[model samples]
Target: MNETIGAAAAGPSDIAAAAGRLTRAAASGVPCAPVRDLIGRDDLAAAYAVQAALTATRLAAGARITGRKIGLTSEAVQRQLGVDQPDFGVLFEDMAYADGAVIPAGRVLQPRAEAEIAFVLGSDLADGPLDARQVRDAVEYGVAALEICGSRIAGWDISFGDTVADNASAGAYVLGTERRTLEEFEPVDVVMSMSIGGQEVSTGTGAACLGDPIEAVVWLARTARDLGEPLRAGQVVLSGALGPMRPVTAGDTVTATLSGLGTVTAGFTEGAAS
Candidate 1:
């Protein structure tokens, strides 16, 4: 969370090339080679630059930014990526699915599922200390969520910069219907159990998410502000995964239960994306 925000050392051409590679991958449903060669493996700023360029393209195509998603909250994942802090990605309105919905398998290449806590903000976070208290106060409500993660990079082999440039490897998400206020339960204390095809595949607690999901938001709010894109009112934030992520494929059903929050399910179907 102590990471700084600044312009990437890579020039505009490299940034554009990285973005173009990811854009084609998403558009054609074919993963591309890692973009680290263009943006540099350890350059967070440069990677984010590629993400920003893609975001601009999406906005130009009339895509709406519904929220933001945090990634690499798991210490184990951090170790795999060789990073100490989490990264974030934009969440588009089109990426959202209701609870118990059937998701198309073709929507994402090499999809994976993980449980998470989703917060809908009631107030703007542009100006504040962005502490845990402020994050809790800003929330309109909380819900159980399933993050369907994917990578535009081939073989899912990526560096910190590659994943960041690919929008934290975001694909889609499902939000549960049940909602609760912060007063109803503690986010850091929530227990999670996730199952696929009637078998439990992942388990963890709220503490798994950057110590607490609120702490993740605090990190995001500050980072987003520093990057000139502060969070706004009514934005949905997927704090991060509460447990290990399991690979999901066609016809797989994923159910996740979050204590004090509620249960959410996502059914995957084979065929073209809808």
Candidate 2:
């Protein structure tokens, strides 16, 4: 019989160092070496561990945890990243903005925007696997949302490990004012359109997001619970992007409108508080 071998696990110091590198890159607004280069590539568990540690570092620095964001739920993004499943990251209070707010371009490195449906939970989701219906029932309402994703990995050269260690490449997010209850909204049938400077760039339906945006939320709830952090009530959940992400540069104004949900806008400026 032949014996099977597994990849070596990363120790505490390795995880801490990798997390520190990511923290430095994010704070400096400069890209750094991929985490896989510092730690080995095959240890996804270690990469997530680094992500947790990185979140802790931010929390210690006065950042408050707002909610979570799901990534790679779209088949296009999954294919782009060469992954078959989804990944998630923590969202911070400082990362949120109201509709039509101008985002500080200087704070983000290599920014891009994606349209998504945002769910605000009415009840706490505890540990265990949840179906899409179960996930949908818990939602208080859904709103139009735009996620600003930024990569700390140089030139966006990222593997799964690199992205996971970089907080799912999340930078900031904005939510529109329109809110509709589950009874009035069909999570799987909603259509979305995104435009930059009044030029249509991408279009997709709610089905593009892991079959339905509700399914993405369910996956996040279960995945977070398994990771020892359950989804809580009042936390905003970005279900995932409906279409391909579009590059965002300084002075760019991006808008996304959903079928039932109203439109949301985000403007980027060259400096802070534009």
Candidate 3:
């Protein structure tokens, strides 16, 4: 009944306008219809192009690209989304927080939390096919991370194209202080447990993220390269969720602890913008 980004359909040529509408909704903390519905195109390539256009708009508005995030890497999450491969999104400098920071609930729409393994790159990864070992070798260290995801699409009803165009639904992220070098970490076997209000809510292992988190990084590297945007040195890469994502409410405290990688926490407060 309402005309929102996802409520109405647009032609394939409406990519730019669709991106603009989504960007405005995100900035205003409002949810809209899925871009896929608005654009009338489910093409992943076009979706990514829209994401790039949105990122450019942000950059033009004084935002800087700090890193990237990999999403939908878990088999369970993939199965839920009906997608067989992972997707990537750009991370902005303003979207980062240190462990134990208090986050305003009004900043995001329908936020959810997921535990992650964050890789800080030591050297630039060129665009090309890479293996897990190559991905690991470029890492400066691995730290426990929490990806706070929020959807700009109304009701979180989205297709793969919708999320891709929504910048992988990335909201904010917090990284632990205890960073371990590759020699000190075995990512594939690390265990992660998340808790809210002092009660355990979700648990998972590194293997749950594309068999090994490094593989996600590798996939991202290749994919970004193909998209003509290679991941760079000094950039932090969120290697997907280690477990199912849990909803966040105002006044809730969420904590994620990763074996050998340490812990990260986020506090949500009331009075969100929307």
State residue 140's C-alpha deviation in candidate 2, in Å. Answer: 0.3
Worst 10 residues of 3 by lDDT: 1-10
lDDT of 2 by residue, 64-130 (tens): 9989999988787777777778889999998999999998887678899999999999988884446
Better of 1 and 3 by TM-score: 1
The per-residue C-alpha lDDT of model 2 at residue 98 equals: 94
Between the candidate structures 1 and 2, which one is better when assessed by lDDT?
1
Per-model TM-score on C-alpha atoms: 0.99, 0.94, 0.93
Query: Which number leads on lDDT?
Result: 1
Better of 1 and 3 by lDDT: 1
Ranking of candidates on TM-score, top first: 1, 2, 3
* Residue-level lDDT tens digits of model 3 in 112-217: 9999999999988884446677788899999999999989989998887888889999999999999899899899999999999899999999999999988888
State residue 58's C-alpha deviation in candidate 3, in Å.
0.4
Please give the distance, in angstroms, between residue 55's alpha carbon in candidate 2 and its true position after superposition: 0.8
What does candidate 1's lDDT look like per residue over 1-274, in tens digits?
Answer: 5688677899999999999999999999999999999999879889998999999999999999999999999999999989899999999999999999999998888899999999999999999798888988999999999999999999999999999999999999999999999999899999999999999999999999999999999999999998989999999999999999999999899999999988999999997676
Cα lDDT, all candidates: 0.94, 0.86, 0.86
